[model samples]
Target: MSRYQEMAVFAAVAQAGSLAAAARQLDLSAATVMRSVAALEARLNTSLLLRSPRGVALSPAGETFAASCQQVLQAVLDAERSVLGLHSDPAGQLTLSAPLLMTPQVLLPITLAYLDTFPEVQVVSQARDGMPRLLEDGIDIALVVGPLPDSSGFAIPVGTVRPILCGSPAYLARHGRPATPDDLRQHRTVAWTSAGYVTAWRFCHGQAVQWFKPTPVLSCTTQQAAIRAAVAGLGLTRCLNHEVHRELQDGLLETVLDDFAPERLPVHLIYREGRRATVRVRTFLDFAVPRLRTHPALNG
Candidate 1:
């Protein structure tokens, strides 16, 4: 097999996690998929995968090689599409990652609009509370909120979202509203946790910053769940303004301690190095950046 064919087979097997699944995807026999991968290992003189009844797991070396293979394959596909003049009409699978709550409220609407404009493109979205390894997860784009670590990728500033402390009208009416950050101690809170530990609620005013570690009456892993709990009148919850915009608008929830809220968190649309960006990625950026930056909820 040619080097390109070998790389394609290896990448497929790595992604599918099983020879049988890879074969099905490639419309080749299971033995053929296995042989192609085995040939690649032989050529490299390194064990690429550990096969078992459950599935195949890449070795450390395999992980490194697979990343390279994916890049090469993508470059090749981009080249072909460019030559065919199809690059102007972006078409391919785009994998996007963002926080769970933001996916439904913010990201999904943008993606749906993008798809409407470019029907040829397909999107696969991954929603989780915490960051996922962009390269490992094969994410084409990520909508990240807050400070980003120094990295090779390009990050385009979209807008900002500030955390808002809010609760159902009924909950606030019964328990009374917190007038200041310090008064939160007397209130029950629905806290959002990451990796099983609740995150401290932070507030700021002028030069002062305060961290309130709430002994939450209810703790949940996702912001969406915490927002739901708060809306159900369980307790007060702190989340991004965009996450609860509809509820706040409909009079289901009301914000408190607005005077002490922290500075707005920066929102960014991140992707790999610009030189490596595919047509779909660039197109999405052009399509999304202006809209996101102008969004009232994100900008406020």
Candidate 2:
């Protein structure tokens, strides 16, 4: 077998933690797996696995070697993809663009898990401020929230998220809950303004739409910063449901104006093409679509 093949075998063994387990995972015979592992150790002049009656474990050198193995293997795959193009193997780079708020909270964990699951696939995640041009940007997929003005891709509806107004229990107790968006004037409002001084919060109940411009006690550039300030009892903050998912679950914040919520923005996984897509893109979309659809962070 080739050196790369040997490294792949050893890496699988390290991950599975046993020769038999790795063999099963790779769909290779136990004897072939064992031979590959032995060959690797002999060639490197190092003892990699320490076998026990129960199972096998990586030695100290093996642990360090395994980490490098993953890196090297990924680098090789990346190079191969660049040269050959992804026709058959689900191994290559996939670029995903998304809104900044969705990246860390709603997308990072899933992407990290995808990397683990598809060992040969590398991900490039871009946090976009505006709608992405997938074909122009060479992006494989985009996780978008809300309406698309361009609407030029194959969209897979994932879920929905709405703008939420929330405040800490302490702040609510100090200045009773705002019954309506207009009542926010009675309370300190923390508005998210990247470059502006004021914010017009729109509320929609059925067909009636109302706009309330809050005089913010504190204005933040980032949604997370606004949420933090609100959590500290500074004031009520407005953000998407995905932003305060953990906060709501942990009881750090409570929703204030559910009845006046403006609109539920649909989340979509937009890709440039369907059948013509690379194997890397197809596999990634299949992995991410269902996960995002059911994730509580974005779901209404």
Leading candidate by lDDT: 1
Q: In order, how many clashes per candidate?
A: 0, 0
Candidate 1: residue 161 lDDT (0-100): 93
What lDDT score goes with residue 19 in model 2?
89
Model 1 per-residue lDDT tens digits across residues 1-300 = 898899999999889888889999999999988899989999999999987778899999998888889877977898999999887888878888888777877888889999999999999899865556678767888998888888727899998999899999999999999988889999999998867988788899889999999999998977789989999999999988988877887999999999889888898999985866899999999999998898776876
lDDT of 2 at 271: 89
Instruction: State the TM-score for model 2.
Output: 0.70
Worst 10 residues of 1 by lDDT: 128-137
TM-scores of all models?
Answer: 0.88, 0.70
Task: List the lowest-lDDT window of 10 residues for candidate 2.
Answer: 85-94
Top of the candidates by TM-score: 1
Which runs in model 1 stand beyond 4 Å of their true positions?
A: 15-31, 53-67, 195-199
